[model samples]
Target chain A: MTPIHAPDVLISEVGPRDGLQSVSGTMSTAAKCLWIDALAAAGLREIEVASFVPPKLLPQMADAAQVVQHALRHTHITVMALVPNLRGAETALRSGARKITLPISASQAHCLANVRKTREDMVAELRAVVALRDAIAPGVPVEAAISTAFGCTLQGQVPEDDVLRLAVACAEAGASDVGLSDTTGMGNPAQTTRLFKRLFQEIGERTGAAHMHNTRGLGLANCLAAYEVGVRTFDSSLGGLGGCPYAPGASGNVVTEDLVFMFEAMGVSTGIDWPTLMAAREPLKAGLPGETLYGMTPEAGLPKGWRG
Target chain B: MTPIHAPDVLISEVGPRDGLQSVSGTMSTAAKCLWIDALAAAGLREIEVASFVPPKLLPQMADAAQVVQHALRHTHITVMALVPNLRGAETALRSGARKITLPISASQAHCLANVRKTREDMVAELRAVVALRDAIAPGVPVEAAISTAFGCTLQGQVPEDDVLRLAVACAEAGASDVGLSDTTGMGNPAQTTRLFKRLFQEIGERTGAAHMHNTRGLGLANCLAAYEVGVRTFDSSLGGLGGCPYAPGASGNVVTEDLVFMFEAMGVSTGIDWPTLMAAREPLKAGLPGETLYGMTPEAGLPKGWRG
Candidate 1:
């Protein structure tokens, strides 16, 4: 199959949701809104603003509805939220989320640990969530992000067949899109390319973002391998804020600044204003004091004659 | 040209040389010998042991001759040293270094700043050094490492043609091999692949190790790109020591642990025993009390079921 080289790639910012959720401190709703607005202004077309879950369980995302309400004001950006079940999906849709992602673990152990349900049970929950979306919010799109699609910290070595089977189940369950995630960051570039190529072959147009972690320092390499196999949308975080609780000492998502620099330097436009995207980090830093923000490009400055 | 997929790729450890040279702390010859012994025990076949430079200029490498002599005790490991000129090359050969690498900056500004000489003057120096190796130490191999081959902090955007021309000059100057060094860590994978492919076309089998830095966090990605283009022999530092002094805030050489993990996970053999290689870091840490060490694989541990 020929590799798809798109003129522009979509960099979906997930810092507010994924970045904040994993950290200890809770960002204020107002601070979250400012961060979201800065991201939007930096030409990010998609932003996963919040996750719909009980405030008691995750106080970090307690202001999910408020954050979503504010993010929806930027009509140009796709306001996204994470949902665990039908109730969360309903809440997300009601809060004006254009996109809702449901995470289904390919590894049974991770599935049990993360959502307190079996993989089959999670698929059933996804089916219910999709049904609710179609019934009450037919226009809103629900995407199933297959977590531990690469490997699992609990079970380890999640088979490719299991991941493909789960993805097919999600597609068959009325979900609009399916994405593969390296939740444990146990992916090598070769494995990333092979799995993503198979994903495109199986799910075709339903294949979505590549959510790779920098836990083992293969995040960007894995992303590049996926891109080489025609996967365009990439999920990344500003400052690489979120760490993998499963993989000790492993960093969080791929840093957005470095990713943008890679694509832009290669002559592939990400449509992000370089200076503006970098400026967005200021508010993020202000909101999360004492948190160690990680990004190489921001620290190293741009290369000589770099206009991006 | 077909990409070379060697059963075993050489991991040329540059920690004792590049790692020590860049950092402020000076490691004693005894500590250096312990680190070298551990590296050899880990199955590393080759290591850049030290730099043959004036002690007054770099007190970090004051025991260069002692380090090289101690490293030579391991008959299985090839002792290598960096040489800046014919004088250093002679010193390295007399000290029983099997291999000597001379760095030639591709960027004129970097060449001036690093060695206080123009590019043309450096080419002349390489010629003299190669001649000295041929005359005095006929068995010792000489390699010219084109530093800042990617780009430069002082003179950003080193032209591809200039780099190719320099490689040709070094090859013509009787250097046994010519390698590319991302001295400023300004390389992306695309540029890396493009440049290395061109190098093979120009120099053929004379193309040597790819010395990539983890400065902008694209070190492993850049190495993968070079490997994909048929280049073999990677130069990396244990625990990711040796930051680019030219590029502020840039990290160090590609982490040896992370690089090994990448290739080993992809079914590419690195020969080095995983646990033994990680154990080598203990000596490195003990030698430098306050210096910061880096490597994701050491921190994250090995993936489940990893035998190597």
Candidate 2:
């Protein structure tokens, strides 16, 4: 439990969702549930089990509803899923996800190039999704993940003003919280602190999870920068899964093991045990045999006398 | 250059000294020069070039004199060397090193275990070394690094009072600066911030670099916490080389390539280019073939269209 004075940091494992989405192989829904159970047993309070996008777009997530159903069995853990628009959000709600993340690209160029939607159009679509979620799961939380918040591959540098504007619109359009993502893994500590501070100050308490990439290896450091300024929730993929196809080796989200290691080792009480968290990696690697897994904690093991 | 009022973070590469001391292989003089040159080319301004300990203790650093001589060829970088006592300090002074670090283990157990000296005895030994450096190299900067600032494997739960007292003694004993180290890789972010804040407030401008270990995987996060509370310099090993023999995989220092990637990608201006930095990893790895290298940046390529 978080003390009123110093709230505990929330490490949300995105391995099952974001991690699997970018990989080549498909993990059976049962294997994913086992992985999710392992993560929750290790004390991860939230897990992004899968995304609700159409199977045609993401065949790996064909059984999103099944994964969500299994994840809901562990009532203590908050089950989250990614949704692109109204249809995906509707699917996620039906699958019993308590939280749905709508990825809204902050860069128009990236939104058009990747999602085939303009920034304004994405927000307009989100309004309907938010309405749909309210109708189905009235108390469910809706998050607008502002992808490419730091910079983008297609657009280069994402202007800070554009990020803030989208954040405001997301909140106004009914997103319960807004997140910042280094979709291309281009964030530095200085830029991270600047942008996150601006978002919190401008948007008040609506700032959400810090979705960072390990591409440039700044993922953990960038996350720390965000945490220093009041971001409690963090998104990380296991084994540093999902390399940016454009930047090979950069796709893994910040390795969940490493992030948990950082918080737990620092005596910050991340509620994760090094041994149990590390044990979860085996299932992840077993599910994706040929894919190269990235992370140092698993290979190096935890330092001696580390408390959970 | 950091913008006015923006946070300034320093990347102190300790590959040549702390890194090589632990590995079994002796790097060819040419490989050392190439690695140091490559690091400088990648915008790493401060690097610990070599240790001045006796060759019998660490044959890997046998080429310290030659390595330091070669590093001097690059006028833009700051070359530092580690010295165990006055003898090593004298050797470092003879080699034209402008910066010298004297390791003083804060944990009495680590001091006796690592340097074969008692805490009081080491402080007395350091006072003499400081005097020797002042007489031999008047203008050269000498820093006393207080190791095991957080916790110790040998003693466990190092008293914060011991760390603070050692910091005061080092400064009072003629040291130009004082630094803290988590030699056992047991530091946490909250403890890091509190310790740094206490040290800075007590010693003010005398605080120096943060030498951390990635053994438990919180090195970068601890560095971020220190930076938040006003620590400016950070020490990292190249290829994440160097760990305590007692702590398996604790041998890797926080990898220089990954640390640089973290800072640069955040647009924090490490001044290091990704390609050049990645290219440097080859020499580091080539020097020790069987030794496992740890780092996220080199394994994962930089994000696409990365500006720096």
Candidate 3:
């Protein structure tokens, strides 16, 4: 198969949303804004700034609206937010999120454990959220992220048919884009390529980012596999912040620095300045003291005379 | 390009020689044999048991001869040792090593720093080693490993032409096989595919293992790229041991457990039993107390239905 050599790939930063939500420490609204600013300065075009969940349920994201408002100041960067339901979608719209992502677990077991909803129930909620988004802010793009799309810890081997059926359902329900996520980091390169190629075939341009984890150390491999099969958009966390709590011993999301390095080294433009992106880690480390940050590119430094 | 679909891949474990050599702690000869036995039991057919360097230089490998002798007990497994020169090669042959690997740095600067010899000087030594091997034990295979073949830490951007030229020189010098190593871990998937494809074109079947590092977290990605280009043999360190001392902040070699996981998940047989391979880590950990061992597969555990 011909490898998809995109001129540039969009690296959507999900550390603030997916990362912070999983960690015990809560980054203050100001720290979140500073981190977002640093990320934007490093040439990131899109960032999932926060999740619109109830503060009581996820107190870490209590200042989601505030973080979103601050992020909106950088008009060039697309501010994205995670919305669980119509209520979350309404809050995200009010907060001026340019794009809202709704995570729908492809694995029924994971769906129940994570959101306490059945796959069918989540799809209905997605349709309602899509309708609400259209009614309130037609400009905002609503994306349905199929988490546990590859496989699941609670429920292994999420059928490809089920994943495709869900993707079709989400697209039919008015999702602007539907992305696949390796929630349990159970994806291999071959499986990733096959699944994503199918998704692209089934939904065409509605196919979105490949959200992989460094858990199994196949994050970059899986991403490369997806890239080879024509997937361009990737979701990563700064310093690999968010580990899947459900998947025990799994690492955080693929680190953005390392991801940029991989693409840039391969002559794929990510629009990210390597040194600047690396410099942003300082503020991130400051925000999460004693919290371990992981990325090999930063630790190994750049290759001699390298430029992004 | 058509991907190489090998039915079975050879995973040459390099932890004992490469890993223990770099780390500060010296695993006892008894411990080395036990670790090697555990590895062989896990179905690793080829293992670089020790490096025949001066004990004064590397106290960690002072018992190289003893380790090699012990390793040779496993007649079913190929006992390999690393030799720097003809003297080391002679010692390796006497110790009953089935195969001996001589590392010839592609980067002139790295060659000087590592072995205190120029590239040409090292090639001359390699020729002498090959002559010595043929004279003493024609049955024993002598491999010339082109270190920093991908890129260098001190002198970056080792030209592909330089790598090919060196490989030709080594092959002409009587090496049975010549392999490329990402010594500084400054390799990407694209570079890996291009270089290995060229190596296969120039040397044909003489092209050998892809020795990559997890330094920038592209180890498996680079390996996969090489695999796509028809390189089947892979060199990995169990527990991801052996970081490049010259390559600042570089992580250990590609974790064998993780590599096996990737290939097995893709239905590529490595002949290694997954659980048994993971169990091998216990003895390794016991040997190197307080020394950090790395491998995502061991940490993340096996996938739900994974067998070997």
Candidate 4:
């Protein structure tokens, strides 16, 4: 792999998409746009603006296309959108998303339950999506997110070999990068270290961002484990939002403020400032009132004399 | 260090001392004892039960002696207490604490502001405490916890040499072990890795627990970094309780439930079951009404099919 000038870690904020979606009240399209702009001003280089899923399925994401278009206006940051399947991918590309994330569940049961498809079928769908993206938008990055790469709640104890197989399959199917997700937040540091090591070893540099849930509270720990093993880009929802609906109150994604705080405070250039990013929360909270937001950094106030 | 059976990691629950003290309300002695017992029942081996400061200083910890007595009932678990000075050490010994932790601030400004003593004076106090513990309870462990080991909120960017010197001085002063604390919560994974590596290299096996906070939200990230470099015994709080009075909300120690979940999910044998441990939250939360209780594992329901 070429030595990238980017710092050792990259915290990709998924608040606009994962976080907002989990919130009960919907943010106005204008509000969403403001939050995105605020985040960019806060020095976040990458942000998952929205998912191109069916608006009927998730009304909260009804204005995703508009958000993506606005995010694309700021060319400095990479604009990412989540695509549940081929149709979602098409919507994301049409809306000008430079990067499209495809979710492929590692657990067949989760694949069946979450998106109503078997694991193999999802892989085939991802292959089709990869082909479609390559044909329609060649330079655009295509990521096959192997969801539940860590143990899954639907199907307990996903085999490491199975996760690796799906990752290889995703790569073979033409994904530009293969990411891993701890959909259930059941990851531990040892498992995190071992799995990421195996992933990097087997998949080589094809490993992508770690899309982890804070459900079991290992979000940051799992992220650190991934970082230690050479995975840089991490997908975290602001306020730790976007928990599994099946697990209410669990949807809090690893709070972006906290995640950025964790990385930046340690002197890792996440390219984010805690105070500025924390200030961004006001717009977000304004967008979706009556939401139960969570994050220790913003509430705790910055350490004694902490700087950006 | 003896070659004892090293389970994947060590999670020291600091909710009683570090977690509760950070919050505004004080848990009743009975409530504190109940929570400590619940944590011990959940397979926590080491727990920081209470601080030994004077009642006049931290009224929340006035019932420290009673809590200590309650924690001592569990033979399998080791009871630890925090002390700010020699007087506190005296209190700790009288309470029959098996482990006494002294916070020795690395930042001179933090030392003066926090403990009202200089780093050198803290070291002298640690020496005296060690002597007291040795004389009164030979088998009891005495640890000098170097706070702001990574950086300080009061004095930004504490010198590495200063931290190392403090650790060395504490060891020379007869401390049984030396621990590092991110008092200001200004720790990142890389810095955590480097600081721990340096401490272990400088202090060798004398290095103790990784005392961290979620202030800037890198608690687990820092913990993982420490674990990667061979440091064991992480200090955490149950429900991520305990906000520092001085640094309101800044005291959310690493959440114990989340820490255990992270470890156990990684197959690290924390000997803690998430469900049972989470059950302790209700009682803990009920003890302090209106206080914000923080914990990912408690809020996020356990993953679908976890055995432990």
Clashing pairs in 3: A242-A252
lDDT of 1 by residue, A1-308 (tens): 01145337899999999999888888888888999999998888899999999989999998999999998899988999999887888999988899999999999988888899998998899899988888888888889999999888778798899999999999898789899999888889999888888888998999988999888888888888888899899999988878642135554689998888888877777888888988899889888888778778777877785642
Task: Give candidates' CA RMSD values in order.
Answer: 3.6, 3.6, 3.7, 4.1
In model 3, where do residues sit more than 4 Å from their true spots? A1-7, A243-251, B1-7, B243-251
lDDT of each: 0.86, 0.80, 0.87, 0.78
The true-versus-predicted C-alpha distance at residue B55 of model 1, in Å, is: 1.9
**Chain A TM-score relative to the true structure, per candidate:** 0.95, 0.94, 0.95, 0.93
- lDDT (tens digit, per residue) of candidate 4 on A65-159: 98998889899989999999999998888888999888888888888888999878888888888788877887888888888888877678898
Better of 1 and 3 by TM-score: 1
- The docking quality of candidate 2, as DockQ, is 0.43
Q: Give per-residue CA lDDT, model 1, range B81-131, as digits (tens).
A: 999887898999989899999999999999998888988998999889878
Candidate with more favorable, higher lDDT: 3 or 4: 3
Taking the candidates in order, what DockQ does each have? 0.52, 0.43, 0.53, 0.52
Better of 2 and 3 by TM-score: 3
lDDT per residue for candidate 3 within A1-308, as digits (tens), equals: 01245337899999999898888888888888889999999889899999999999999999999999999999998999999888999999988999999999999999999899999999999999988987889978999999999888887888999999999999999899999999888899999988998999999999999999878788899999999998999999988887542134644588898899899899888888777898889888888887778777787788885741
Q: What ranking emerges by DockQ with the best candidate at the front?
A: 3, 4, 1, 2
lDDT of each residue in A24-136, candidate 2, tens digit only:
78998778988898998888888988898889989999999999999998999999999988889998998889899999999999999877999999999889988987789
Q: In model 4, state the lDDT of residue B258.
A: 65
User: Which candidate number would show the highest TM-score if scored against the true structure?
Assistant: 1
For candidate 3, please provide the TM-score of chain A on its own: 0.95
Number of backbone clashes in candidate 3? 1
